[model samples]
Target chain A: MNEPILRIRNIESFYGPIMAIRGVSLDVHPGQIVSILGANGAGKTTLMKTVSGVMDPEKGRITFDGQQIQGSEPHKVVQKGIVHVPEGREVFPLLTVDENLSLGAYTLSDKGQIDHDRDLVFSYFPVLKERRGQEAGTLSGGQQQMLAIGRGLMANPRIMLLDEPSLGLSPLLVQEIFGILKRLNDEQKMTMMLVEQNANAALELAHHGYVMEIGRIVMDGAADVLLQSEDIQNFYLGVQEEGARENRRWKRKKTWR
Target chain B: MDNAQLLISGLANGCVYGLIALGFVLIYKATEAVNFAQGDFMMLGAFVTIGLTNTEYMGLPFWLALPISLMIMGALGYLIDRLIIRRLFGESQTAVVILTIALGFVIRFAAGLIWGHEPQTLQNPLAGKEIRFGGLVLGMEDVAVIVVTILLTWGLYVFFSKTKLGLAMQGASQNQLAAYYMGIPVKRVQGFIWALAGVVAGIAGILFAAKGSVDPTTGLLGIKAFAAAVIGGFGSLPGALAGGLIVGVIEPFASRYVAAGYSQIAPYALLLAVLIFRPHGLFSQVRVKKV
Candidate 1:
């Protein structure tokens, strides 16, 4: 019951000469919200890209449902039921919202399944159904982000890799989106790997959380445990007690890699 | 200038340019490649029909020859994409642009070898036919051009805006990386676009040949068609046709009223004007993202 659905072992990825993600390992179990918390330049997006087969890892292995899938093409990875919702919500600006969602279901040949998936997406985000025919670019940033998420849901993916869902949104919108994500996880039992810089919002919603730094995972535990840890509060949660930073620096010596 | 007569004649010629511009826009949209060989594809389409319908050749009826010629041209476009364009996929677009420019010369030479350099016309049922309405006479060939262009425009519009595959293609064209993430086979969609461009080029050639004589050099008209595409915002579909009509109508009127030589340069002059005024061209505001 505890078996991980997606596993990565010491995967390395490069962009030309520079290594973007170096020797990273993580696991996402079924029907759980796994959050990777990091600041900018922490290789959070790179990890998502590598797992989705958008970037072929230079070394190590990625197994999804016990099958090696590290170097498969993006479309092939999608066919195996992993959908990547990219950073910056790159919905086709000129295309209608309906068109974008239909494209997300590109791997599905069953018309009935596609319709069902689209209906589910609309139900989750009723605003999407209202603006279905409108060009995606015309939508507000928050609406576009929902459209991006709804578009990803069109695939009926086994595990969805979400890159910064809270990015560039108002705090209220962030809470709204995370609430929907929590609902999706609980009601549909949808598994998700969420990468975020919004540690407070992400930690609140995630079942398990990992803190990443400079292309490596520095700390990981149950979301509540990580939230309560003194070192995490000082570093990620930005709690400032007298000499808390000094205490974190001292504690770093004992933290596991 | 006789306004009604010139308008009809101009519209007929405009339809041919519009059809050719349609090919340019179709290919350019799907793949960022600016195919300099589009005109030569047009030449090949006209020659294929001539070879089929002419008395000295296969002598197929015009109706039968039309579809057969379209299929042949479509196949040629697809093969060109699979063998040549696909090879140039990761290479700089300049490589493709140069290759297609060279292909234009090669295609023309091949057509000359097959059909000879002398001007040739299709043996068709529509030849020399005319329609008279309130003393406004129009060639049946001109009428056919207008009718066919409308039908093709409607058909392509429906295909692109309404169908799943078409929407996928439009998505792929706008952003390949995002498109790939959505499980679109971007490369395969591009190949289909080339095939479509070929079919469109064929239609333009058939209409042009029906209206007048064609030779190995007839492909030079592609420059005017290219100008039409520029005048229509390169990012938009409907803009392409409007651009073509503007160029086509300006041509005869420019010659009749302004001067004879002006007709040849009118489209280019208008193109320059559009570039100065609306840099993104008319209709569409989106600037095509450069690779």
Candidate 2:
């Protein structure tokens, strides 16, 4: 598929002696939204951290655009056009919204380009425009998520890695943000690697989807196929059989089940 | 005019203390460490200037000697971070605080060895000069101190708010990991902050020396500056200056009017009062982040 823009092979990352991501491999092609669906402890965050060089993999090869970037420093990785919009919306609370976006473009040298990128981000999340001068801490949870994504867009990244953009937001807000992600993918042809627990929304917009279970990938397929699969419907999408309530403990499992 | 005279002198003293306190706030905000060695940097700054301006030492002109001393102090600060503080990464902030306190000792000892235990003053063009207008009389040195301190404080406020590096530094101070994600070199920015604090200490040292005499023990003045930082609300730059001024203005009045032996406790007394009443000092920053 036109040589996937990011290639991760046998990436084994750890938290000290505890292996969090165990020899998992995946690919994300250019101009495509690839969603990695997993439960809370599925190592999705760790995988994103490894690719963005926040946490170095204990053993693996991560090549972006055919250059090794597995163990590079986070800033160096950013210069190579990999932006990680980390979980929990870690915006600089004391800084103004404009200031936060400006810092996201810290790797870029051209001032004009920075201004243009800022304008582009403002267009995507016009609410951020309304609160450009407000301190980021004052933003609502939904707006903070938008600011986080807008900050990533300020980088003009070749590929953006988003860890749980739908996290800690209302379902309505989640739908709105996912709709924007869909728009960005269609309009700007933005390449995004989205890690999410909201399987239904993520798969609905993603070009391809992979289901991860406890640090390993159990299913990978076209988004539509994965959406219709009985395993995905039962486990991820929570689409139980007719008149069957998903109330039991230890009821659903992964592909193996 | 007697009180006016007292006020002018107090303001000048407060300016110096505030300048030093600014150094404290700069370092604390970036690294979350109380740099007890900050006053030592000031002492070394004055010693360096004295070494340069006095004919018996470097014999350099004041103009040449000033920038040179600042650069030297800046390098010392950067080196301290690169060589010492960076290694303390992943360690507790308390460890950094203790390390800085120990460094203060080293600095005091080193100054004693290099310049001798006797106090020395810088030979400058401004000392012993005065300005008089109407009922108020002010020392030219004091006037210079007040004017320069205002300028420096304003400059720092602008730098933090207007410049790109300054904003990045602020972002890094607030969230180091997110700053890294934004492509900011957080560690190097921290090193630069130390360098900036060093330069500030040097300028304060030179001005303090011009105002009076300096010895190995001069750095202990940083203690009062620390009090000023706390009084300034810890996070606010203007607050630091106001805190310094508050401490400075009270000292003379306390010694002149209060009971004997209590004059020495005046600044600390004011600090205690402020802490008890304001709690967040007279000026808190950014309004608790709107949570």
In TM-score terms, which candidate is top? 2
Worst 10 residues of 1 chain A by lDDT: A243-252
Best by lDDT: 2
- Expressed as tens digits, the lDDT of each residue in B1-291 for candidate 2 is 788888899899989899899899889889888899999999999999999888889899989998999999999999999999999999999999999999999999999999999988889988788788997877888999899898888898899999889999899989888998988988999999999999999999999999999999999999999999999899777888888898888888887788656656988988899899999888868544322
- Model 1 misses residue A94 by how many Å? 1.6
CA lDDT, every model vs. true structure? 0.89, 0.90
lDDT of 1: 0.89
Provide DockQ values for all models, in the order shown. 0.52, 0.65
Question: What docking class should model 2 receive?
Answer: medium
What would the per-residue lDDT of candidate 2 be over residues A1-257, giving only the tens digit for each residue? 69999999999999988888988999999999999998888899999999988899989899999999999999999999999999998999989999999999989989999999999898889999999999998899899999999999899899999999988899999999999999999999999999999899999989999988888888899999999997789888877677655664353533433
TM-score of each: 0.95, 0.96
RMSD of each: 2.8, 2.6
Candidate 1 lDDT, A129-216, residue by residue in tens:
9999998888888898999899999988999999998888999999999999999999999999999988888889998999888788
